[model samples]
Structure formats: C-alpha cells, structure tokens
Target chain A: NAGVTQTPKFRILKIGQSMTLQCTQDMNHNYMYWYRQDPGMGLKLIYYSVGAGITDKGEVPNGYNVSRSTTEDFPLRLELAAPSQTSVYFCASSYKSGRSSYNEQFFGPGTRLTVL
Target chain B: AQTVTQSQPEMSVQEAETVTLSCTYDTSESDYYLFWYKQPPSRQMILVIRQEAYKQQNATENRFSVNFQKAAKSFSLKISDSQLGDAAMYFCAYYGKGGATNKLIFGTGTLLAVQP
Candidate 1:
C-alpha cells in the first residue's frame, strides 16, 4: 500500500506565482502536516490539521495555506512564491495523539519547488 | 514552544562501524516524544526510531537504536554496521503529548556519511 503519495515531484515557478502541493495518505491517519526543508536544514512546519476541516497555522505559516477536506488528502498552497519558498516540501501524517503511544509520523516523498 | 537541536552538522563513519548522532531538546512539559528521521538523497523522510518520555527503555529498530536521557533532554541515534546506503540527513523531532494538535518540532539535521 502506498502509505503517503505526493504529486508533482518537482516544480519551478516565478516570483509571485502560486501553486499547490498535493498529498494523500492511505493510512487513515487523523493528523496531517506540511513542512519545508531548506538546504542543509531541518524541516519547518508550515501548516497542520488535526482532522478534516481543522487546519491550523504552524511555526512558519506566513506564505502558505492548507486544507484537510478528507482524511486521505491534505494539500498545501503557496501564494506569491518567493526565493525563500524555494525548498523541498514534505507532508506527514500520524495517528491520534495519546499519552501512552508514540505518535509516529509517516512522511511522503518531498516536493521540490524552486522559485525564481 | 518546544525546540530541538542537532549540534553536529556532518559526521562520517567507516563501513561496518558504528556512529552516534547527538540531539537535544528544550521543553517544559514532562511528557513528550522524541524521534529520529532519515532523509536520503531521494528526499523521503523515513522514521528511524522513536522514544517516549515516560518509557525508561530505549527504542531500537534493527540496526538503529536511540539513547534517551529524559533528565538531560537528550535523544541520540546510534547506527550499527553502517552501510553505504545509510548515508543521509538525520533530523531530531519532538512532540508534546495531549496537545490539541500533536505537531512536531524538528532540529537542524546532521548529515551522516558512510565511507567504504
């Protein structure tokens, strides 16, 4: 089974352009997240959803938007792309949060976006 | 807000040898989770191992093991019998338990190189 699938493995856009990065998971996880990884850097959260229709801003959510319309899909939207937005994007999902369980995040193959 | 830190920017190990990657985190909460994720050249983030704050036993996954020190707030990854395919960027992540959204806080990664 494809645990997580992301579309448009690579894309290039001009400054101010907009695009969407699509992510889908077959694990039926309840939590989904969008993160960007810069060169030689760790991932930074952009947006997240605890469940369908429950999106929230993350640490670095200024230039991005997200929607969780279904348990399987959570898409990330980049509006007015900037040079700083040229990074690899990853989507991850996890099961419900609990005190006794370790919330293991399953990640999709990243989407590489380049803004010029 | 919780924060994760990986002090080593790069580490190299000989084939069949073992290597340890260090990670530290800062958080006021008593219960949380720690994880190590590996991102290879293909840019897919894969879970290497995980540890829960309340668990005294360290987590291990085959060749990968974690040294979890709750008092010092450190979670380190140890890779045994390093293989060429093991070279990747390793990220340390933290998650708080019982949060409305269990979002992960990632550290600046450490690039591990396996030398034959």
Candidate 2:
C-alpha cells in the first residue's frame, strides 16, 4: 500500500512565485503533517491537520498555508515563495495519538523546492 | 512548549561497528511519545524506532535500540553492526499526550555516515 504520497518531486520557483505541494495517504490516518528540512538542519513543522476539515499551525508556519479538505489529502500552498523557503518538504501521517498509540508517522518522499 | 534537541550534527561509524546518536528533549507533560526517523539520500523520512515516556523498558527494533532516560529527558539511538545502508540523517521527535491534536516537535537532525 502506498502509505503517503507527495507530488512535485522537485521544483524551482522564482521569488514571489506561488505553488502547492500535494500530499495524500492511503493508510486512512487521522493526523497529517507538513515539514521542511534545510541543509544540515532538522525538519521543522510547517502545518498539521488532525482530521478532515481541521488544520493547525506548526512551529514554522510562515510563508505557507494548508488545507485538509479530505481525510486522504493535505495540501500545502506557498503563497509567495522566498529564497528562505527553499528546502526539502515532507508530508507525514499517523493513525493516532497517546503514549501507547503507535504514533509512528509514515512519510512521503520529500518535495525538493528551490526558491530563486 | 515541548522541544527536541539533537546536539550532534554529524556522526560516523566503521562498518560492522556500533554508533550512538544522542537526543534530548524538554516537556512539562509526564506522558508522551518519542520517535527516531531516518532520511536517506532519497529524502524519504522512515521511522526507525519509537519509545513511550512511561515505559521503563527501552524500545528495540532489530539492530536499532534506544537508551531512554526519562529523568534525564534523553533518548539516544544506538545502531549495532552498522551497515552502509544505515547512513542517513536521523531526527528525533516528540509528541504531547494531552492534546486532542497531536503534533510532533522535531530536533535538529544528526547526519550519520557508515564507512566501509
């Protein structure tokens, strides 16, 4: 089963350009997250969705917007791409939450977006 | 706010040897979840292992085990008989137990290299 899928494997956008990174999961998970990894740095959370119709901001939500219209899809939109937004974006999903709740997130092959 | 930290930016180990990647986190909640994810050159984030804050027994997956110290708030990953395939960027993540929407807090990743 395809756990999580992200579109636009790679892209190059000029400053002020706009783009949307698509993410979908077949696992029917309740939690989905978007994160960006910079060179030699850890992944930073950009946004998250608890379930369909529910979305929330994460640690690094600037320059990004997300929509969770369906349980299987969570899309991140870059309204005005900047050089600082150039990074590897990852989408992840998990079944549940809690100390014992697996909480193991299945991640998609990241989208490498370069803002020039 | 909960925060995860990976102090080691890079680490190297000889083939068939063992290497340990350190991780520490801070949170006010007593019950929570911790995880280790590996991102190879492909940029796909893969779950390596997970640990529950309340569990006294450390979690182990094949050759990957965790040294979890609840009091110290440290969760380090130990890879035994390291292989070339194990080379990747490792990230430590945490999730709070009290929230209805569970969100992960990630640490600055540690780059691991296995030398043949």
B1-116, model 1: which lDDT tens digit per residue? Answer: 78899999999999999999999999999988899989888998888888889999999999999999999999999999999999999999998885667778889999999999
Candidate 1 clashing pairs? none
Docking class of 2: medium
lDDT of 1 by residue, A8-103 (tens): 999999999999999999998998989898888888889988889999998899989888889999999988899999999999898975544556
**Model 2 over residues B1-116: C-alpha lDDT tens digits?**
88888999999999999999999999999989999989888887888999988899999999999999999999999999999999999999998888666667788899999999
lDDT of every predicted structure (CA atoms) = 0.90, 0.90
TM-score of 1: 0.94
Evaluated against the true structure, the overall lDDT of model 2 is: 0.90
In candidate 2, list every pair of residues with a backbone clash: none
| Deviation from native of the Cα of residue A102 in model 2, angstroms | 5.0
In angstroms, how far off is B20's CA in candidate 1? 1.1
